[model samples]
Target chain A: MTVHRPQPPEDPDLPERPGPAGTPPRIPEPLSEPLSEPLSRADEAPWRRVHPVSPLIRGWIGLLAVAWFWGQNWFEDIILAVEDPGGRGAPPMEGIPFLGGVAWLLLVGGAVLVLVGLSFFLSWRFTKYQVTDQHVNVNSGVVFRRQRQARIDRVQAIDIVQPLLARIFGLAELKFEVADAGQTAMSLAFLRLGEAKRLRNLILARAAGLRSAPEGTGAPGPGLPGTGFSGTGAAAPGSGVGPSEPAAGAVPATDPAASPDSAASLDPAEAPERVVAAVPVGRLAGSLVCRPLTVATVVLVIGALVLQPVLTEDVSPLVVLPFLLGAAGALWKGFSSGFNFQAAASPDGLRMGYGLLDTRHQTVPPGRVQAVQIRRPLLWRPFGWYRVAVNVAGYGPGGDGGEERSTVLPVGTFADVLGVLSVVLPDPGTARPLELITAGIDGSGDAEGFRTTPRRARGLAPLAWRRQGFALTDTALFARTGVLGRALVIVPHERTQGIALEQGPLARRFGVCDVRLATTAGPVSPRVVQADVEVARVLFLEQADRAARARHRHDRDHWLEENPHG
Target chain B: MPQEPVDPQGIAWTRVSPKYAAVRMAGWAVGTAVTLLVLSVPLVLRLAGIWTWPPLWLAWAVPLAVLALDLVRLSLIPRQVRAIGYAERSEDLLVRRGLLFQRVLVVPYGRMQYVDVAAGPVARALGLCEVRLHTAAADATIEIPGLPAAEGARLRENLTARGQARLAGL
Candidate 1:
C-alpha cells in the first residue's frame, strides 16, 4: 500500500491511454490525480461483492419468517396432541406413525431452516458493487441482474447503517442518498464497521469536489469482487459464532432487513466520523415524553384502559388492544427515529444521523434545502426547546408524512435550532440573522417589520389571530403562525416554488387573506394564514421582488462581485 | 370628509373578462341541470311505469336539494369573477382570487417549470382561456382563468422568456 498525496488536475500535454474497446471504460478518481494515464479495462476497475456473511445478515429476516411459520404449524399440532388425547381431528404426526409428533416436528423445522439458510448463502454470492471516482455503482440480483450508478456530484447524503445483526458482527452498511427525484436511495450493506467508516469519509471527500488522489492503499476495503473473495471472513467470528470456515470454493452470500435486538453490549460508542453536535439521550427522552402528540397518545391509552372494565367481556380486549398498540407505536416511533440525533458540518453541507435499531445517515447540501421550520410546542416553550425540520429537494415523502426523515433537529435549544438553520440557509444576506430568526420565532407582531393579521381577522382565527404575521428580509421570508405550537418557517426566495394567497368565505367577509409559500413535499410548511388582505397583497408583491433579486444573485454570477448599481 | 379605509398592500388589480361572469353562471346552471337530470331520471321513469322497485319521488329529492346549492353557486359566480385579479411584477407573477377567503399567489417566473393554456367547451365558446402555471412544488399549481386566448398566449410566451432568462442567470 502506498501513501498518495492528493494532487491537482494534470496538464493536458501528457499522453492519455484509452482502455480496451469492448469493456467498460475505466473512469479516473477525482481531479487530485494526473489524467495522463488511461485505466486498463481488465484490472483497473471491477464489480465487488460484500462480506461472505452479508447474504445471511441481509436475508436473515426472510429466513426467520419461514422458520416462524414452520414453528407455528408444529406448535399447534404438539399442543393438541399433548392436551387433547382423543381429539376429533387427528394430530399431524398421525400420518408418520414411526416417528411421533415431536420427532416429526424437529425433522421438518431443521430441514426448512437448512434449506432457507442455503438459499441466503447462494443469494449473497451474486450481489456486488463498485466505486469509481465519478460514480458509485452497485450490480445486484440473482435471477434478474441490475446495475445502478449514481454520479458522485449528485450524491446528496450518505448514511452509515448498522442493523442489530450487522452491529453484532461489527459491520456497517453505506446508504447513499442521491439527488435524483424519481429514484430511491442506494445501500451498500454489510461491510466491516471500520471499512464502512473509511469508505464514507473517502466517498464524501470525493463528492464534496475535493477528489482524493489516484490509488493509495490500493485495497478497495474488504468488499470489491476479487479482494472480498480472498480476504478472510475474520470479522465473521464476532457474530458467526462457530469458527468453521466455509470451504475455499464455497460462494459467500448476504441479506438485509434484519430485526435488531435491544442493546446487548454498547461498544464505548465509536466517535462519529466528525461529531458536530449530538442531542443528549436524556433530553431526547424528555422531549418525546413532553411532546403534545406523545402526551395525547398516552392520555388516550389511559382513558381507554380506565373504560376497559365497564365494557362487556368481548369488548374489553378490543378496547385494550388498539389503544395499547397505538400508544406503544407512537412512543417507540418518537424515541427510535430521534434517538442519538447527531449533526455535523461537512464540506458537502450539514450531515445528520439518527435512529436506534435502524440508524440512518442523511447528508443535506446547503442549496438543496428548500425551506426551514422552527417550531415550539406550548409545553416545550417553558423549557425553550424547539424542533427543526426542513423541506429538501429530491428527498421525497417516504416516512409517515415526510416528517421522520426530514427532521433535522428533533429537539433543541433556541441556539441549536438557529445553528442548524444557519448551516442550511447559511447567509440570509441580512445583517442580523439571529435577530431575524428570534423575532420570527417568539416575537410579537410589532417586532421588526412583521405585520400581523387584522383585528377583523380576530374572529376568523380567534386562537392565532394576533400571532399570524410575516416578515421578509433580503434573502428569506419568515411566516409566523400557530397559537399552541408556534411555528416560523423561513424560506429563501431562490428555493421558493410558488407563493399562494387563499381566502375562505369567512376570511373574505373578515377582509383578510392567507398567503402560503409552497416548497416540495416535506415537513416544513411556510404559510401566513389570515393576514389583512392588503398586507397579504403587499407581501405577495414584496416577496416576488425579494425572490427575484435573491434569485438573480443565486442563479446568476453568485461568485462574481456584487453589482454596485443595482 | 373621511375617505374609505385604504387598501394597504396596494397591488395594482386587473379583473377577469366581464363576460366571464355570465359564462361562469351559465356553467353552474348547466352543471346543476345535468346533476338534476341524472338524479330525477330514475324516479321519473319509475313514476312513468318504466321501473317499480325503487319509488319515483325519492329521486326528486336530490335535484330539489341540488337546486338550493346550485342557486347559491350561480349567484356567487359573478362576485367571484369580479374578485379574480392578477399582476405581473418584474420577477414573479401574482394572482388573487375568491370572494370570502381570498387568496393571492406569487409565482416567480424562474420557478415556473411550464405554462399551460386550457379552455373547455364553455370557456372556448366565450373566447376565454385559463392559463395554468406549474412550479416545482406539488401544490403550487396556479390557474388564471377568463383571459382572452390572445392574452393567455402572450402571457405564456412572456413567462417562458422570463423563466429562461432567470434560469440562465442562476
Candidate 2:
C-alpha cells in the first residue's frame, strides 16, 4: 500500500540491477518499504502510473458516445422547432419546468460529463502497470479491482495504437498479443508515445530471452539457451535492440526515408529496416475506385441526383440520403485507413504504419503468421492490383482495429505484393516461390502443378470451376478460388490448426469435397473449394501428415529460436 | 446404388453410445413443443378475436407445418446419431458427423488449447457426457457426445495430456 514515486532509470539513489542488453533500464521499487506484508518476488517491479491525461482521453471517447446517443434527439427537436415556427408556436424549451429544454439538456450533459470525468479520474488513479523479466502486469478497475498479467514468453506481438484523439495528444495505447486467441491479454492505455515505444521494446527484448545489463549497449547479443543460438536473435525478428550497427544479414533495402514524417514514425531508435512495400496515394485511390462497391455507390448517388428531378415530381434525391451516408462512411473508412500505408521488414518481423487521422504501428513477430492470402478483385484485374491479408493468432476475429490490422498490403502491384509476402513468409517452403505464387494468383487450369476442379464440377461452380485449384507444396498449402475476383490463400503446414473435409448433398453428387485448413480467425481462409472427391480425401490424409511433420520441425513455443535468416 | 462413404484411411472409428439417440430425441421433443406453442400464438390470437393478419387458415397451417418439420427431424435423429463417429490417431483426432452434409475434421494434438467435458441435464440423466477439443481456431472445435460419463472424463484426461505433451504455442 506504500506509494512509490516514479524516477528515471538512471537514478543514482536506486541500486543498479544487471539485465538484458538493449532493454530500457528499470529502477526497481525500493525493497526497504513494504507497508502491510512481505514483498513477493513479482511485486519488486514498481507499479508505474500511466500519463496524467489518460482519463481525459478515455473519458472523451465515452463522452462522445453519450452525446451521439442523446444529443441526436435533442438536436432534432431544436431543428424541427426552428424549421417550422408556426407548428409548435412556443420555443422548443417552453414545456420544461423552470429550466428551458436547452438549459436542462446542458445541465444534464454537464452533470454526466462531471460524473464520467470524476469516475475516470478515480480509475486512472488506481490503474497502474508493472513490467518484470517474466511478466507484464496491469492492475485497474476501482470497483471490480481486476488484475491481469501476461507472461513474457507467451507474448505473440506488440501493437502501438494511436486513435485520432490520442494522436493529437501525442499518446498511444500498448496492446499485447498473448497466447490466447482473439483477446489482447493486457493493454496499457494512454502512455506517452515515446514511453509506449520504449516499453514495447523492453518487453519484446525480455520476451526474446535476451541478456541485459545496466546501461548495456544496444546491440544484437547472445540469447539464452534453447533460443538465439544463431546469435542474431533472428527468430523473433526485430526483438531486442535489433542490430544497432546494421550487420546486414536478411533485412535488405533499408529505406528509412520511405515515410515522409521520420519524427512521428514508430521505433525511431530501432535498427534500419527493409522497406518492402510503400503504397502510393494514387494507386490506393485508383484501387479503391476500381472496387465494385465504389462503382455502385458512385452510380447510385449520380443516378439519384440526376434522374430524381427528371422522373417523379414528388421523389427527391434526399430519398437516397441514408444509402448515400452509409456508402460515404464505408468509403471514407477505406480511404482514410489505407492512407500512407507503409510496410517494412526489420529485426522485428513486419512493421506496418497506416491511417490518415489515426496512425497505428504494429509489429508482427516471426513465425506468428498463420496464413497469407493475396486477393485480386475483378475490377482491379485490369490494373493488376492485389491486396494481401494475413491470419495471425491473437489478432482476434475481425481484428480490433479493423481489416487493416490483417491487411499487410492494402493495394499494390504484383511486385509489391511479392515483396511484402517475402518478408511475411521468409521460408515459403518452396524453392520456386515466384512461379508458384504467380500461378496461384493468375494462372488457371492445371498450371504449375496446381490441380484444378474436375470437368464434372462445371455444374456446381459454373463460372469459377476452371479457375478453382489447389497446390500443396513442401511447406505450405495454396488454395485458389473465384473467377472474377481471384484469391490465393497460402497456409504454412506448421501453422495449420486443423484440417477438415466437407461434403454437402450437392457436392457429393458432383464427386467433390471442400478441404478447409483451419487457421486463426482472420481474413485469410485456407479453403480448397470443390476439389475432386478422391483428391480431397488424399489431401485430407496427406495434409494431416504434412502438418504433423511440419509441427515437429518447428520450435513452436520458442519463437525466438527458429532463425528464419539461418 | 450409391456407394456408402467410408473413412479414407480405413481407421477404426468409435461410435457414440446408442442411448444418445433417446437423449437427443427428448431434448428435441421439448424444443419442438416450445417452438409449436410459440408458432401457434398467431392462431390463438386470431381465435380469441384479438388480432388478424394472415387468413385464419394460414395461421393454423404454420404450426402444422412446424409440427411436420419436427416429425421429419425426429425421424432423422437416430440416423444422425449413428452417423457421428470419432477416432484418435497418433498425433491427431478425427471426428466425422452429419448425414447428408458430412464433415470429417482432423485436429492435431499440438494445436489444441484445451479439452472440455460437458453434459446437459438430459444427457446427465442418461449418464452420458460430451468431450470437446478446443483449438486456437474457433471453427476447428470438435465435440464428441454420447460417451459414458466415466469414459468422457478419461478421454478428456487423455486429450489434455496429449495436448500438453505436444504443446505447440500459438
Task: Return the top candidate by TM-score.
Answer: 2
The best candidate in terms of lDDT: 2
The CA lDDT at A49 in model 2 is 63
Model 1 has fnat of 0.77
Docking class of 1: acceptable
lDDT of 2 by residue, A1-566 (tens): 22343632433543332222223323343223321111123546556667656666666655567778768857765666566544363354555542255677777877776676567657876787877667888778899988777787777778888887777766789988875666788888888675677667566645554423112223332122221122122212222211122333312222333332321121123433566677777887898788788899889888887897688778877877888788778878888888777776665567787777777788887678889999999899889899999987768666477578889999987767766777677666666777888889888889778998899889998998888989977778889998889999999898888999998898888888888999888888789999998888888888998888788777544445445333
Instruction: Say which candidate scores most in DockQ.
Output: 2
Worst lDDT run of 10 residues, candidate 1 chain A, spans A261-270
TM-score of each: 0.70, 0.81
lDDT of 1 at A100: 66
DockQ of 1: 0.45
